[model samples]
Structures are given as C-alpha cells and as structure tokens.
Target: MSAPTGKALEEVRAKAQADVRALRKRVDHLDNDAIDLILRQARSHYAWTDKPVTDEIIHELYEITAGGPTSMNTCPARFVFVRSQEGKERLAKSLKPANVPKVMGAPVSVIIAHDLNFWTELPFLFPHEDRRPHFEGKAEHAEVTAFRNGTLQGGYFMIAARALGLDVGPISGFSNEIADAEFFAGTSLKSNFLCNIGYADETALFQKLPRFAFDQVCSFA
Candidate 1:
C-alpha cells in the first residue's frame, strides 16, 4: 500500500472534519451520569463475582478502545485474555503474591503488551505519510514510542471496559521479565500491565482514597 497524496489526504481530512460536526449534532457530549459510569464512580475491583466476560464483550470493548488516538496511530497494543484455568496458572506465576489471589478470582485477566515492530504498520495506519522511518530498525526509538502509545491504549482499554459495564483492576505488581518469558517468548512484544475484568464484588472495596486537588498538581502554562 502507498501513502495518500496531498490532495487525497486533504479530502480525507475534510470529510473527517465534517464528520466531527455531524457527530456532535447527534450527541454533543456525555452527561454527568455517563461520566460517572465511565470514570467518577468506577472502582478498581479486587474481588469479582462469578459472571464471565464473554468473547463478544471483549470484541465490543476493543472496537471502542481501538478508536482511541495513538502517536501517529501506531496502535501497538497487543492483548492476551487469560480465561482458562491453565492460562491463569501461567499468568499467576508472574504476578506478585499479593495480587495473585484477586487476579486468579477474576473471570478474565488481560495482558497488555506492545510490539517493538509497531511502526511497520504505519503505512497502513498513518498512510498520509511514510512514518515508518521514525521507528523502523531504531530499537530504542521504537521501544519508547511503542511503550508510550501502547500504554495510552491500555488506559483506553480500561475506560472502554468500564463503559461496557465491566469492572477493571489494573496492576503493575508483576515481574515484566517473567511475564514476557511466559507469554511473549520469541516475540517482539513486551508486557506493559495486567488488568482483571469481571463483575466486581463491591463488598471487597476499600475506603476511597483521596486524589490531588487541581492546585496541588496543576500549573499555569
């Protein structure tokens, strides 16, 4: 495949710009209830109920999450859903002892990883320009871009899961080396984080923790 020419790119951009207006006309913004459902009232679950996260739901969540923007649309995230007992057993070996039980109880645990060869897809994803040169064969550069954008996609994945009515528990309490060896052997992928997904057991929740106020963490530009 080839990159779009200047005129072709302009036309595509114009159509997308027009689409923004059309989309806003249908739903200008999400309401407070929607916001609360997706973010504010959402909790990171520690215990999960028996309800399973189905394949259809996983696909549905991905369809929405993949729409999230990444740097030059590199979209490097690679997800592995561990639902079987055998898969869970392998995954648990890499998780910290403290996180193992909760993760094991989850109906599904996803390994979010990034591909070092992500830029190879730039010709297809970011066809307006040949962006591959920025990362191709540049190991250090590719790794940074992959991890950064892949992590952004990970956040989108959690938000999408919440929006789809599944509770999420994201954790970095695991050994990356072990996880990579177990799941990504002989591959360019590197594990970023793990997220447990299922119907949460609300009773297991801890007291809400305080977050930094705007003034405490923000500053004027």
Candidate 2:
C-alpha cells in the first residue's frame, strides 16, 4: 500500500479521532481484549521470532506514544530503532552478555534516550506561554525534568508497541557510556534504557511472574 501524503495523513488522523469519539460514545473503557493487548497479557519477551518490525509500524507506535501527556508537554524522549546487523553489533558492544543476544536476535532494539536540551523546543511544544525561561539557563533543573519526562514517554512507547502487537524486552543492564558515545555522539541525548522489539518466541518464555497486589504496593495518601 502507498504511504499517505500530507493531506491524506491529516485525513487519517481526523478519522482516527472520530473513531475514538464514536467508541467513547459506546463505552467509557476499553474491552478486555484491548486491556490484554495493551497491558494485561503482554509479557517482556527475551527471545524473538523471525518476523521483522516494519518502519510503518514503528512510525505509528511513535505517533501514539507522542500523544501521551507530559509535564508542560516537554516531550524529551528520543528513540533509536537499532535494526541493521551493523547497528545491532554496535549496540551489542555496550550490552552485558545476556542482553547482547537479546538485542542481536530481535528485529529492532530501541535505545530509549532523552535530550538534555529539550527545553529549546518549548516554544513549539508548549507555546501557550514562554516556558523556555524556566529551563533555559538552569542546567541541573533541565536535566532532571528531561530525564523524568523522557522516562515517562519511554514507558508510553513500550505500551504503544504492545498495543500494536509487538513484544517488548526492556532492560537497563548495559553500558550507557558506550551507547551515548556510539549512537548519540556530540548530541544532548542521553541513554535511559534499551528494549528489544519484535514478535516473540512464545515457547521460550518463562511462566508469568507475579505482580504486587494493590494492598502490597499502594496506600491512601
């Protein structure tokens, strides 16, 4: 199928918004299948099948991910979809032994990174007011906000991928220094974590692990 042109893209987006509104009119919450697709039944996959993650799906994933709200809409997250053999090799050099195979075997390995200079785009992202002054000269504050919000976007990214039928394997057991040097050289982007994205080899999966119950993890403030 042909990729949509500029106008076609706008039409597609409009149709999507309309569809959401129609669905909302029917029901306030998603069906169980959607809950399963987005979160409930999704698992962190370490082994992958041969199917490749196409560029179109990656683009759609980001479109959904970017829609998620952030503080002042800072939108600091930057993703590098490491797919080529050479790219995976470069990334593998930064990985621990166990994570190396996971990256190499997956069709796409994502470097979920953040831009320290993200505030420069506040004029475009948060144009309601001049928010740039709050972050411009404050290096420490900017870095903290970038990291916090960028991590939030990264979580949205993974959930979006899951919603789009891709398994995600998020891991932090890697060398940030090497990744920043290899993939983000001379850039403000700093590595947060890595994720293996692809169709999973379900046979290789371990039994589902237990999660903490609400009583164990939450309390009224």
Count of backbone clashes, every candidate in sequence: 0, 0
Error of 2 at 116 (Å): 0.4
Q: How close is candidate 2 to the true structure, as a TM-score?
A: 0.88
lDDT values, one for every candidate: 0.92, 0.91
lDDT per residue as tens, model 1, 66-185? 999998889999999999999999999998999999888999999999999988888899876888888767899999999999999999999999999999999899999999999999
Query: TM per model?
Result: 0.95, 0.88
In model 2, what lDDT does residue 103 have?
86
lDDT of 1: 0.92
Top candidate on TM-score is 1
Tell how far residue 178 is off in model 1, in angstroms. Answer: 0.4
lDDT of 2 at 88: 91
Task: Residues 1-221, candidate 2: write the lDDT tens digits.
Answer: 24456888799889999999998899998889999887888888889899978989999999999999999999999999999999999999999998888888899999999999999988788755778889978999999999999999999998999989899999899999999999999999999999888999988888889999999989998
